[model samples]
Target: MKLSRILKEVKINSIYRTGAKTIKKGGFRKNSNYDPDISSLHYRAQDVQPGGLFVAIPGLFADGHDFIDQARMRGALAIVSQKPVQSDHSVTENISQTKAKQIKNDLTVIEVDNSRKTLAMISAAFFQNPSEKLNIIGITGTNGKTTTAYLIESILSAAGLKTGVIGTINYRYLGKVFENPVTTPESLDLQKILDTMQKEGVTHVVLEVSSHAIDLFRVENCFIDTGVFTNLTQDHLDYHGDMDSYWFCKKRLFTEYLPSGRKKDRAVAVINRENAKGRELFEILPVRGISTGNSADNMIRPKKIEHGLNGIAGNVLTPSGSFDFKSPLVGKHNIENILSAIGAGIALDLSLDHIKAGIENLFYIPGRLERIAGNNGCFVYVDYAHTPDALSNVLGSLKAISQKKIICVFGCGGDRDK
Candidate 1:
């Protein structure tokens, strides 16, 4: 893509051409007008290809700005940075001064105030803003995001729509599954994946939105059609510092991001009314809000529910209609997940039958209270419940169903908030 087109939505401070002095003024060069054709975008110096644009991101571990010469040596045509580009350095001091000067003279550097945000905007523009073309459901909270996302994905798939999912387990679409390194990927990788999904005819996408992703501008320009707030609990306090900051980060999904989605008229917030934080979020949502929980006042709730070791069966009541839903997912906590998914389905204008089928079709979600058959009538379950609230819910559910004693084994990771 042309450099100008790639940076269409980016907040550019100034653009400097080859051999051009760093202008003090904050604007494009009027005299030196050259928009280089960028082959690709890269944050790491090692990934830069010939004619690629390198974005220097200031990170906690290492700064990308320090490796600008390496990116240039790898034939990066343009450079994007928050700091002023230094033209005097080579990839190493071993290189002669003449070679360094020649390399600097052939490069184009674009300065911006925030490189991370700029990367997101430029990536969206370069990828033609793929999130805008598809209905995207963003699930955020301390827990239940993965299960809720799986439920929503199943519903969308039942509607005969091609679906894509990005979450903690994996990113899968069109029979392809990629391991997920993080709950939410960086903006460039995310945009590229969404673009590929759009090209493959995916009509709906479900994303697990993390607080870190929101705070770091990873999902900056992605248009979210439906935003689901499962529930906020005391988790990730180590990264966020406090409950208020964490809540604020989650609130941005509804208040700031949802308004800019393609389905502006149809944008909806699915909130867990049972949760105190979720209840507060529902009242302040700018878009249409669908309250979901076990309460009668909730827009989506499960009635005549039965929970057992086999699974959960219930009649889900939604604004559109009521339907009988069955799932292999056990526990009372899953009831909230199902309600959130039901609300998301309703917000997306799906039929009750489709939602019912979707809920029933999913037999299991990996590591979310997965049941394993054991010898001598014993039952073993493996679950990814790291937080105190999550563990409490899982153990509470086991205690409720167990005829005998329940043995629990768990380990906590080092350097995280307990």
Candidate 2:
């Protein structure tokens, strides 16, 4: 496809340059015009492939202008850059692109006010609206997004559909999983994952939608099918500065980012009825919502909460009826987790039996109430509860059943949310 063809489907400001003979002239092009078969669009020069447009975004610490020459050198069909336009001959000699072939590729560069948002839009067009074809579940809140996403993936997979999950712990697909250090990856990585999931016949993809992901527009233009709110607590103060901003950041999942006017019947929201923030989010959902909590007063309630030194048992109350189950996971917090899972299962039209089986089958949650063995009858647990509410819930649950003193040994990170 020609550059003119892509511009017709999506708006294009300018075409600064196009196909060159070699990397020195501009960059590598499989041919002359853009490739219609390209899998995805990317911003970083390093991620560029044949015919992909390399968006030169000005980052916080490093300006993307510095990498434009490199992206072109590496084979960017076009450059979406923020740097004040310098004549092609004026590229500073100080920056070297020896690895990008000879001289930096003098490809076409599109100037834009906000390239990040532009990248997202171009990606949506390139992917032929893949997000619309599948159920994209976005789980937000200070805590439990990852766990909730994991539970969603497990429940979906247990019901016999290939499920994909992207969160702090890892990005999962089929039976294979990759360790992901970030709660949410960049937009390009995210779009790539969505594309792969769609290609592999995945029916559902659960993503841990972080406050940062929302703020940076990493999930821009990708419609969410269902959004789940776990609970909001005192976290990310360093990034958000205050609870109000933090709450607003998490709220974007439902209020601002949900797909607009797309048959509200297909969209659903599952909220933690116990959390005030969750209630606020529930009020904003476009369609009818499901509420989950251990309290009997909850709309989608979890009853008969029983926890011991061994495991936890509970019954989930749905519009249909209640289904009892046992979970190897312990704590009232875990019960909250189960309730959220049940709500999601119902939202997706899964059977109570399948939901119960999925919840019960999940015995391990890494670094989350993760227990360790010892010689004596004593127990040691390692958890990733970095927030006040998380610590309170875990400690509160253990305190309820302890025959002896329940002592907590903990410390905060050096430069993190202390």
Candidate 3:
């Protein structure tokens, strides 16, 4: 792809020619003669290859601008930075004058107002905007995002649409799975994965969007068709500082990103009406809202629910129709997850039969109330509930179903909110 094409939508402050001389004063011009063929896009200096574009991000721990010289040494043709690349003498201070001049002469540095947002736009452009080619369902919140994403994926798969998933456990499509280091990947990796999924004929994708990813502009260019808000709780306060700041980050998925999606005209928000923050988000959403909960006023709710050690069986009432569903997933919290998935199914115009089959087919999600055989007729279950609210919900569910005394064991990690 040409540099001009990759930066077509990027907001530029200035474009610097070889030797750090100013070429264009503002933005990019389609008819400009400085368009170079870009082979790839990378943020890490070590990953830069010949003819690649490197984006310098000012991260929390380390600033990528410090490695501009390394990127140039690795044969990067272009550099994108929020700060003035020429004004930073630290990048060339250690090198000999001849080598420093060569480095500058071989580079085309473009200054942008925000490198994070620019990286997203250029990545989407470089990959031909794969999100637009697929129906992306973004699930955001604190506790139930992973399970809700799995349910949505199962439902979409039951509808006979080839699907992919990017979530807490892993990223998988067509029998290929990649380890997930974060709930949401960086923009470059995300676009590349979506592009691969699109080429493999995936029609829909279910993504678990994290607050950190949203705030960092990782999902800024994703065209979400359905945005699902499961529920928010007291978690990640170490990073977000307060509940309000965390809520604002999660709300951006629907308010800021969803409205600019490819299916913006049909974009829908599947909200957990039982949650106070979710209810507030539903009221302020710019697109259509599909409320899900046990409340009578919810658009998607459970008509009758039965919970036991074996699993949960219930009839879910939705705008499309009522469907009897059974799942090996236990707990009242999973009821909210089921309703959210059903609402997502309806938003995508899926048949109730498909939704029912999808719900019943998924037997388990790892570490989410996973049952284990125990000695002396004891039942042991493992769950990944770390927050106070999540732990309370798990214990509450167990209390409701178990007649015998229940023993609970848990621990907290370091560097997290107490």
Most accurate candidate by lDDT: 3
Where is the poorest 10-residue window by lDDT in model 1? 23-32
Expressed as tens digits, the lDDT of each residue in 60-124 for candidate 2 is 57766677666666666666655444544223444434543464445555655677777776666
The local distance difference test score of each candidate is 0.87, 0.73, 0.88
Each model's Cα RMSD = 2.4, 4.4, 2.0
Stretches of candidate 3 off by over 4 Å are 18-33, 87-105
Superposed by TM-score, candidate 3 places the C-alpha of residue 379 at a distance from the truth, in angstroms, of: 1.4
Across 289-406, the per-residue lDDT of candidate 1 in tens digits comes to 9999888998888899999888899788888878887788999899999999988889888898998999999988999999888989988899999898999999999888778998
What shift in Å separates residue 246 of candidate 3 from its native position after superposition?
0.7
Best by TM-score: 3
Comparing 1 with 3 on TM-score, the higher-scoring candidate is 3
TM-score per model over all chains: 0.94, 0.87, 0.95
State the lDDT of candidate 3 residue by residue for 164-271, as single tens digits.
999999999988998989999999999999999999999899999999999999997888999999998998888889988999998999898888766789899999
Q: After superposition, how far is residue 219 of candidate 1 from its true place, in Å?
A: 0.7
Query: Judged by lDDT against the true structure, how good is candidate 3?
Result: 0.88
